[model samples]
Target chain A: MDPARRLGPAQIDVVAQLGVSTVLLGGIYALVSVGLTLIFGIMRVVNFAHGEFLMLGMYVAFWAYTLLALDPYVVLFVSIPLFFGIGVLTYVLVMRGVIHASHNVQIFTTVGLSTALQNAALVAWTGDYRTVRPWHSAVVIRALGMAFNLSQVVAFAIAVALTLVLFAFMKWTHTGRVMRATAQDHDAATLMGIDTDKVYRLTFAIGIACVGAAGVLVSPLYAAYPTAGLQFVLLAYVVVVLGGLGDMLGAMLGSLIVAAVEVVGSYFFGVAWKEVFYFVLFIAVLVLRPAGLFGQRGAETLGV
Target chain B: MPALAPGRWVAVALFGIVALVPAGVRDAYLLDSVILILLWGALSAAWNVAGGYAGQVSLGHAAFFGIGAYSAALMTARFQQSPWLGLMLGVALSIVAGGVIGYLSNRLRGPYFALSTIAFSQVLLIVASRWRGFTAGSEGIPVPFRPGFWTLGLGHVAWVYLALGVAVLYYGVAIWLETSRVGYQLAGVREDEDAAEALGIASRRLKVYAVTLSAAMTSVVGTFWAQYVGFVDPFYVFSIDLSVRFALNTIIGGIGTGLGPFLGSLLITSLETYLRATFSGMKTGFAGIYLVIYGTALILVVRFVPEGLTGLAARLRVRSSRAHA
Candidate 1:
């Protein structure tokens, strides 16, 4: 390779260091996008408010940390159920009505929910970034002459394990099978007495629970703020669309691709140029493969 | 031209009262609050076109508003050009930009379209912040009034009323658009794009027109904003809060109805003004509480009275007519 394109010894070491970190980041993104995709698949409604749920969970963890001095990890027991209840309540109160409302209503209600949640956080937390500081120094493991952080490794493990469980539940379990049935054909499921409302409520709850879990898992790695979820929200959208909306595996792959793009682009060009590359990637993918790389046919098109 | 509706006459009367507000109110603070209400009302009304009319909810309309404000600020601050001309140029640019983005995303679904608009707006914001030479970065560039009859001055009651007049004009135009044939087509497209397209409505073209026209109107307000404050900052100009507030106004008032934004703006903006004045130091928290209320209100409205205040009124009017019959 040319000197410019080729990796020197120092550069090679840096690349090796970054490689595992990027993959770990990408794994967390996959986890995020899977939650989003599951909701989209079941309801055929894009939950624009998905990110706010993550914010809400982080805040839950924040309060748990501040008020009770609970370790953020320990608070997951509370966060998951609380967030799940909120999610189910959202479906019952808002999403049910919107499911039958026009496409505008769907977007409007969810966006409203997102805005309201974000502002509520802003008003409550005052836009400050918070973190439950790591219990130990940021430690790294060396394998095959490459290094990865303990935090990243733990997050990556949790993410992968949760994804596997989700995949298995969806494939093997009865409720999961019903959920998949409803996702594939809502009217058919209704005809078969599959209880779609329950599915929707459960699916949304599960989605929220997953994000809440991810929030606690990653809080040690990064700071939490009122608007901290905005970046991830945007990234999740890219992943879902790139992974092919409503495709679980596609979302996982798309997450990797997006993380790779952002990290590599940031490395090669600069941080500012990362978004430019993502935008170009988004447009190109949209033009060439509208259904996304692994997307189902007729799945990506607008309904109304 | 069609005569104004008899019911709208009441609205006109309310406007008449508002028009005399500066004259009746001597306190500058009161006048300033009144001006803010009118400005928000105008901005919300403009937002209703693309969002309420065409059913493409743009969560980043502040981008147009910001661009327009900055364009006018730059023009008048640098070249000493007449602000009225600057306002026109700003509107032109906003229209062009809105058209391009609207056209690009016209085919996509709602959430994707919304994301694209946000992406565009965010990119603009990033550029504005980073390109400090032009935008003055975070410090912001202030423009002092070189007051003339038409230079768009600050610290003047007349200019406030003038801005109010321009806003009223825009509100009227938006109302007119809502009742027009193009308006019908846009609404049809919004309701069912394929159905509208099947009927030869040219949904994409109409969407582009609606988006562009709304952008132009919003940009006009942006220019007025620059003149009112006599300063341009990226933070205030490009904030997502502005877009959220605009959406809140439209939804609360009566989305899809001509008079919805008017009532929504009036009610919501006044509520915001009251909150700001009452809760001096805890403003952020207060604002958050207000958002929670606003969103709760929106969800409730969508659930029960999705047509909003205007829809409720229409129902009342029909009920009374039937009772009389």
Candidate 2:
């Protein structure tokens, strides 16, 4: 609250530097959040286990790089099909039974799944923080007096590319359209001869795979610990809500805003209280626009 | 007294079993385990008041728990006041906080409500962690042992008695709400908010009332927990894990079912404590084996017995009665 402690003339470049770093961090957050929103949008199920899958994905990359000598970038591709299979299996075995259950039941189901995965990781990895040191681990590019980690740039680029591909798939592909139709109205889509169940399965698979890929992408950047994904998971939830629960574009935009606020807030208010600033923002958004910035006017009340 | 109901008889029997645990088992470790069951069960029962009965699922209920622990913990640590005084003060504090949160989530549903609750709790957690001067931050506040009924600084066996009495009182409140007029109204609101509103149930007001009362009850137990542990920290008391545990216990037991939370707490907490004890001294990698099994069990429960143990028991009773007939 002090004037001297507030932004001064010399802090502009530092702000710019923080802003640049945030964009890269935001991209990774967007990738994870998009997957979460997709599942929520299509199935009307909030996947609490989502971060665990991401956590496992990071472990997959870490183990692969450590054990098999495969590069993390390569593991990003290798882990997708595996994660897709896991996602579909999860849907078939667990989600199928509770798809129509009460919201309370659905929430608990995911909560249970989340705990199981988190603890499973704890058991396997022994809570040691491991990081993947790929070939380009130390590569940094400096330009205009600001430095960017090469790996971060790669993640950002890939995230942007994936967002475009997802947009296109939803726009052009028949399966994508069917998925969209199911999301719009499950009953109508079922009536219109679309295999709504299959669509749900595919949407969940794609959604999980997306976050799994994000895990691989971030494996090089952050430590792969038992609870690492939890840190990101809470932030992803804040981002997903900020972007409008089921909106993809909104998720991306919200990520940048969240990332920027987090960076600046931490820089100013101290890192320990970084979450307070955005959580305050998150609460304000909920109070003012429950539907979120990009959400439909009445969408907040629509979820089953 | 009014005619004793069958359900009350079952509750009485369950309490009898719980109260007998300390008497039968003198192993301090085992007694601690049962004591946890009572504490967590009682807290989850409070959660069930709003979350299960009113269908307002909160992931931030630990904020109230933390608030209660701190209110009393701070009072005792700072002023050397009696914890009994802290307990009453915590209840008052939690009611206002929970009421405001309940009111905020009045229009929000599903993820919005869940997210709002998470934010509210995280805000408290951050404040508690950063406001080191007041809270002592993450190092935590340790309450000195001042043994007496007023201070609640009792020895181990006394803790068992105290915890059971509190648990019974909590479960009693839950049973009362289950049969009370307000309980039925809350059930109506939970089943269908729109219909309940149409019937002039004042659903919003009832929800606020439920959450506030639930929070107050949880805070009472929080004070008891602080005294029992003799230490309180921002991280342990206010963590998201604690909030999730309350919800998980309620759901695992049978949300809105009066006897469900206790049954859930008894089963899950006992198993968890047993697991941790068994797995604790194991070599490095095997430390979490118990938790892994426990979490998998949770998944299976949600998968097959989504309605919880009470619902399963009800179904079995119906089947057996039909066969007998």
On DockQ, the leading prediction is 2
Q: Which ten residues in a row have the lowest lDDT in candidate 1 chain A?
A: A295-304
lDDT (0-100) at residue B317 of candidate 1? 91
Q: In model 2, which residue pairs have backbone atoms overlapping below 3 Å?
A: none
Estimate the TM-score of every prediction. Answer: 0.92, 0.95
**Complex DockQ, candidate 2:** 0.62
lDDT of 1 at B120: 71
Candidate 2 per-residue lDDT over residues A3-92, each given as its tens digit: 775576446668778988899889889989988999988898888889999999999999999999998788877788998999999999
Q: What CAPRI class is candidate 1?
A: medium
Docking class of 2: medium
Q: Model 2 off-target regions past 4 Å?
A: A1-12, B1-5, B18-26, B285-287
Which ranges in model 1 have alpha carbons more than 4 Å from their true place?
Answer: A1-5, A66-70, A142-147, A283-290, A297-300, B1-3, B77-86, B282-284
Q: Which window of ten consecutive residues has the lowest lDDT sum in model 1 chain B?
A: B279-288
User: i-RMS values of the candidates, in order?
Assistant: 2.5, 2.0
